[model samples]
Target chain A: MIKDSTIKRSKVTLSNKYKNIYEKRFSSPLKRRLAVLKASSSIVSLGKYVILFGLSFIILYPIIQQLAVALRAPEDINNPLVLWIPEKFSFKNFEISMIILDYWNAFKNTFKMSFIVMFLQLFSTSLAGYMLARLRFKGSGIIFALVMFTIIVPQTTIELPLKLSLTNFLNTGVNLLGKSTTLYLFAGLGMGLKSGIFIYLFRQFFRGVPEELEEAAYVDGASPIQVFYKIMLPNAKGVMITVAILAFVWQWNDSYFTSVFVTDANVTLQTLTTKMMGISGNIQSAISQAGVWQLFDQDVTKNPLFTSMILNTSGVIAMLPLLLMYVLLQKKLFTEGIERSGIVG
Target chain B: MISKLKNNISKNTKIKYANDDELLKIERNIKSKLAKYHEKCEKLSAKYIILAKRKQETNKGNVKRIINVSRQIQRINTKIQRLVANLNIVHEKKFIKRSIVYKIKKKFSEIPYNKQKIVWGIIFITPWALGFLLFFLPPILKSFWWSFNDVVPSGTKILVNFVGLKNYIELFTQYVIDNNNIFNVQILLFVQNLAIDLPIILIFSLFIAVLLNTKFKGHQIVKAIFFIPVIYNISIISSTMSKGFGLYLENNTTANILLTTQLTTFLMEIGIGGSFIDIVIGSVERIFMIVNYSGIQILLFIAALQSIPNQLYEAAKVEGATKYETFWKITIPMVTPILLTAAIYTIIDSFARAPIYRFLEYAVTESRYGLASSIAMSYFGINLIIILVVLGSLKGLVFYYDKR
Candidate 1:
């Protein structure tokens, strides 16, 4: 959905340096207009690249703001405008944010979920798509049609069935007002089930793969799994990455699942987004909610622990890794690629 | 087997019947009539036989005539027997009526498992399933169901009681606890969204998209800047918005911000100070912004332009057509599809996450999830209707290149 204007900038990157030379040869008004047309067309090619470059800064602003906040001393959290680099820098807020979030465990949990979902999605979607695309089975057409239809079913439609199924299986009591384990059951790989949508994308990519390649391999005496791994999967590296990157970012920002599943002190970054509005902050509301008005109001900037909780936990720590990673290597992260494989459906 | 079926079909004609009773009724009536006719014929035949014997004794000519009449009577008897058998076979078994009902039931049963129906179910149902059930279902429904009949604030009753759609009806007609209008909040939201955000998103996205489609230097760089806001974390952006930082320049006024002459911003504030100076400044700013962002529209124009084929323009030029003449004749009709698609998408995104919904969401925290759900469902319905109508109007007008 990047606006098509971003694509147009490619036209400009083409050289306009030879204009005078061309002008001499094509001096007539008709020829001049045609020359201008070619130049203009070349300039238009720069559109997409320019759109991307411009979009980068706008996209990074929030993260950049977060970085600025994190770098500030705990005392400065309340200040709405931090105009420049702080007089005194402190890494203490990072420490507080990390401990509050249980960074290592949360990180581990996130990684575990992302990887598991990716594997489940790729395996399920590919195998299913391959069969739909290739194998001459009676219900193959029905199955392909089934997957395509599944693609459009908004995630909300299956929420009740999914929640009920998860709760019954896990036997974990539901959190009526907050996130529960039920949200993550089949959303991410939970050392158990994986997301259904991931399977759909993978299967689509697999379906586009030609049948003759697999058949030729079969004639040479390879098993189905071997054909997939060596012959097919290896060839579809680009689409696999596209799907993988999509899965990673999607699960990384798994706000809905986390919001529904885990409503506790152990809120992940994604779930924290859902919880934000609930933690309203007017000075009066804060003091009333804190259960210590005078103390909090008078010296939030003074107290170490309170400052840490507010500044480190809310402002800085939540976005630390994402901010760092995006700033450092977002290009690589989103670029997950081996080139546009003929494999992409 | 085919020959036997044909023979049987030829033998029995009265097969189209719903039940045994109707077939039997017709057969019984036919059988009685045939019997009456047969008895009459038999009586005639006996008379004829007796006459023939008398005639044989008296006159040889009379005997021959009586025998001929007797033979005719025998043929009639055989035909009546065949008719009776045919009637018996027609009413013998259930065929037509039972089969009709059976076929109807079979068709209805097949509907649930039909592949196309299942696909439609998945596509239409998934988004709502996730929204309603997983995201808001258990909580909203429980609350809606519980809103009626006091929860016996007495805690002594450890059981949650079933109240009905009363929570729903009461929302609009009365309050859950007191008399308040659920329709008020829903109506306010409906009005604000339709009036403001939908139009803003549609106008801005198209304008920006068009501008980005240009042949300007560093145009791609500029496009990336605008789009970046979309992919930025909602939480981060919202937080930034709440903090009173991202939206404003150093000053709250548009004049100070547009001092840099960012063409789009400057033109947008044309009437800001409400004078001729401001208007002139605004128009120039608009032009600059257009030229700057023309890269995007230029790009789309290029695509739409490229899609038109140069042969068209060359032919037009050859025929001495002006640029304006060529443009109206070519560009507008060709790009209508893309424009429509963009409009629909922009509308969905703009209103789906509007500030009104954000504000109303807080009311949801106070156990107003049902009202929230109703509002959401209603909004989604309206969006669907608008999209369908706009596109539906253009459906016939669409010149599908592939179809052609």
Candidate 2:
């Protein structure tokens, strides 16, 4: 009886609170308008959540679908009932893909190349960016315009000729093609993949820094190079991270330049991206070469769907490292790097 | 006692005036040194000009002399500027003007602080400048030249024969690929598609960025998801997907028809016009490509949006300006510079992934280097023209918010 009375009392208070709010909302025109505004804002927020949820799904759909497809048993490739969830989860596809991709070897090569290129790109592009931003001289305007031109011109336009020059290497008769050194050369010279954009980013960022910081250093007997090392670089931690991440990511995913400069056919140097591209065109032969046909029946091996499943699995494994790295570094990348990149200014 | 104190103050004043005289003497010495360096620089520069004229006339034997003379002139100019900088600091009274290390540093600083910056700038850019001249400029010029010639790779060297405008005429007039696909038609279609896609991408990305910038639940996750496409190996995923499920779906003709044709018919039944429906359908079909292309653009726009100060919004609210008005007056104007960047990026990226790449690739595989270069050159020309047009038009609209 006491419990029932307390419940009744709480219900009465809730109803009384609602009644008071209703009465207050209707008490004045301003109160009514504010009540409507609050309701509309709630509605807007609801719509925003809906839109964002739907778009995020669209963005993530392929990755999610690929993961699901890759995890399913190979026998389920033809099972219409097994759409998303796997009936029997297995690692058979990943094993076959690793053989086809030469996963460990390619991963090692890609990591080394990307890491070294990242540092070289940082050094060259940041130095050039600082120069363009702080130091003015005759013809620097022309140089800046040329940088834009380099960004505009597609790499394909110069690929054939660049390859030719690399073959001869300035009449030294030393062929630099099909070697990792070519990529390092490009990076060290600020001509790596999308280096123009990185340079532009750094320039914009350095321009945003107050001039007085450098001036004070100068007045204290610091040279320009000393100022760059002591004052400017430490303060540009934000853009440095931004450019470093971009340079590393772009180099890691780069297939065109890698395929052109470092041909796997000649040098045995294969990055994951290049490896994936190589296998994608001839998956059936590659699958056969991996000797997977011995394990699976002719029926399963002959199916095109099985080949696609293998291809999809390979794609997943190839991008797995990048995805993992991104997950770990994304907080810093999003908050500090991109927000302070100063691309707009 | 008062008289004694006054005498002591006078003595101190006399010492202070004597110190002032010493400073003046130091300033005079520095000025004389600067004047002597200036005279030496003038003499060296006059000699440099004479040597340059002689080298141009003789075209031989004077290059080293010119370089040496120019180097001397640069060194003397730096010394003069350093002396002037020292003169400015000499009035500080605490500046050590006569230490042994100071004298050595004066000789080695080689330039004043300001002039040193210029030299360092050149030093900093040397790698890029050398790379441009050695790697970029030559290849570009050579390719442009080779486009007009018949280039053949013979052994380790390429042989060239002057073919005039034959490659160009052939590419434009009668180039056929894969038996029936015309090159001119493909290029035109690519350009047409680009024209349609660029604005859709820019507007969609900007809209998404604006929404993402607002506080909402799961905002971080959504933002992270949107950027996945930037890191995605898009070529591999798209190829694999099409090979796997997309092919399966395409083989089923009825399903394909049911989705797009049915929508079109329904829209037509409702009296929607034909061309508008085509655009709507086209965008719907290309929605995946659009999303992938706009990842970087969205990031750029988000950055641009975040950089705008909050005071503008607060002031607008206080003045009774609605959200729409604020978006137009404050948001749009503030992000216009990034808008230009996103537009250029969209155009260049689209052109990179354009189907014309296959044609160029085919030419390369066929060993027709001349034809490949022609295709590349023409494509680059169109790209430059489009970029120039966009830059010319958007130059006036990009509003840089200069904090200074």
Best model number under lDDT = 2
- What is the fnat of model 1 with respect to the true interface contacts? 0.04
The true-versus-predicted C-alpha distance at residue A249 of model 1, in Å, is: 2.0
The CAPRI-style docking tier of model 1 reads: incorrect
- lDDT of candidate 1 over A104-124, digit per residue (tens): 666666666556656554544
Quote the B-chain TM-score, candidate 1: 0.42
DockQ of each: 0.06, 0.51
List, residue by residue over A108-137, the lDDT tens digit for candidate 2: 999999999999999999998998889868
Residue range B88-143, candidate 2, lDDT tens digits: 77766644435566677677596777787788889999989988988899899988
Chain A TM-score, prediction 1 = 0.65
User: Model 2 chain B: which ten-residue window has the lowest total lDDT?
Assistant: B12-21
